[model samples]
Target chain A: MWKWLHPYADPERAYQLAGKLLPWFSILALGLILTGTIWGLMFAPTDYQQGDSYRIIFIHVPAASMSMAAYMGMAISAFIGLVWQIKAADWAAASIAPIGAVITFIALFTGATWGKPMWGTWWVWDARLTSELVLLFLYLGVISLYASFEDKVLAARAAGILAIVGVINIPIIKYSVEWWSSLHQPSTIKITEESAMPTEMLIPLLINIFGFGMMIGALTLVRFRAEVLARNGMRPWVRKLAQEQGAA
Target chain B: MQFESISDFFNMGGYAFYVWLAYGVTFSSLAVLVFQSVKQKNKVLKQIAQKLAREERLKQNRSNNESKT
Candidate 1:
């Protein structure tokens, strides 16, 4: 069933594909982030009670969402690598960890900032917050585990196992609000039905979400490409490709 | 507009500090990500160049030694 995946197994093919994908993602990320932030801060009408303070949601929500999304992306890549023994896939997965960890951190940090104003406290040991914190640890664990090994193969497998195991926390983070009465708000953007947010607020939130996703995508590709180059540095093809691309 | 005046806009109805703080931190973090990625790519390129140059020097040394003998 996965027979069509052979082309991507090659780092050279993956590199070319990554280059093709990044520019579009970068453009979209830049466009959406700027438009979303401006529209939310200025153009979109403000909350009757919260005033401009409500504008913080534009960045806060997007950062929080992408933080989780990036993790899922990495875990899936790791899982594919482990099951299929695809070395390139494993490298891509490992390459994505630091970026994902940083994104997760932004989520928690920004959440606290938003919390201080809206909830009247900088922090509360709420389920959502706690689960997000766990998510951050999971990311760090993967990075450290991957680095700890002397052999690259052992490192890949170890990190892959951690990624797959740690993914159970993602759902816990997602449902933390619904499972308990927490200070952190429930998900505003729902897929089962219409989102609860009004159109004025919703539009900017959606744009920012797409923007953050694009930015993550672009960053992941650039990082993944670097990984491919490093691993394939001794290969005959790496030099040929780099020279032809004028990178040499 | 949520505020009555420019001052109110800046003030954020008394929540300005936390609100602006969130945005400032978020934007800075994203900026750092972009900066680091560029830096990483450049560093990798430099390392690759250094490796290639060293290999060339080693190859030249081997050739010179053989010719001298």
Candidate 2:
């Protein structure tokens, strides 16, 4: 029953699996984003007040949301790998951190750009924004800690510990906008809302959100595969597998 | 579609710079992510190849010693 699942825990098996997943994710991400971007920028109705300035929401909201979401994923993977000694999970945690950090910066930067005219400033220490700032620090800490160790295994373990300990703050970041004074807007893009937003805006926004999620998942797998190969640096199978990918 | 003309659309209600800038930054970052992933995959493959060659040489040296003995 679980035999199929067990194969994936092996790094070699996981590498093969990543290959299969890569195309599906890449295609979906590429397609969805292409559609969402064109629709968002051109087709979506302009905001009554902000007009086209509101278009940034397509990218901003998705990346901002994914930054938090991806961190949660990294922390959870780190915690599991640390506690259970799941090596693949730790490699994944280490691999995805940098991508997550970059997206977080993108989100913050884009948000700032959007906010400057709307909020009259380039930056703010708002609750969600501050917590997100802290999120970026966590990502950097993980990357730096992993690189600090000369031993790759030890690096993964140390980074895993850091990520696990840092886990307590994710929810704090998510709820910060609700909890404190912030220029950041509350969750207007919630799924739980009964009838808050009109359908016209919500559809395109949701499409973009899912598009970004697919993009993140695909990118994470790509990076994790690299981490696996790098950690298994001297393994014969890794070389063989890579050659196979090159040929295929 | 809402714009009266191409120039009007670019203006984006007097917030064109910020609007275009935000979208531009987002697109560029995503492009970078895709580029880096490809680069990382290629680098790892090369590293693995080098490691495999080194291991083969070490094994060959060990076997030669055994045969002479």
Maximum-DockQ candidate: 2
- Those runs of model 2 whose alpha carbons end farther than 4 Å from true positions after fitting are A1-4, A242-248, B54-69
Per-residue C-alpha lDDT of model 2 across residues A1-248, encoded as one tens digit per residue: 45666677788888779878999998998898888878887778888877678888888888888888888889888887887777888888987899899889988888899999888998887678888888889999999999999897788889888888887778888788888877777877665656455677777778888888889889999998888888876577876776665333
Best by TM-score: 1
Q: Candidate 1 local accuracy as lDDT? A: 0.84
Q: What is the DockQ for all candidates, taken in turn?
A: 0.51, 0.57
Task: Provide candidate 1's TM-score on chain A.
Answer: 0.93
Say which docking band candidate 1 falls in.
medium
Backbone clash pairs in model 1 (N, Cα, C under 3 Å; residues 3+ apart or in different chains), count:
0
DockQ of predicted candidate 1: 0.51
Please report, as a residue range, the 10-residue window in candidate 2 chain A with the lowest summed lDDT: A239-248
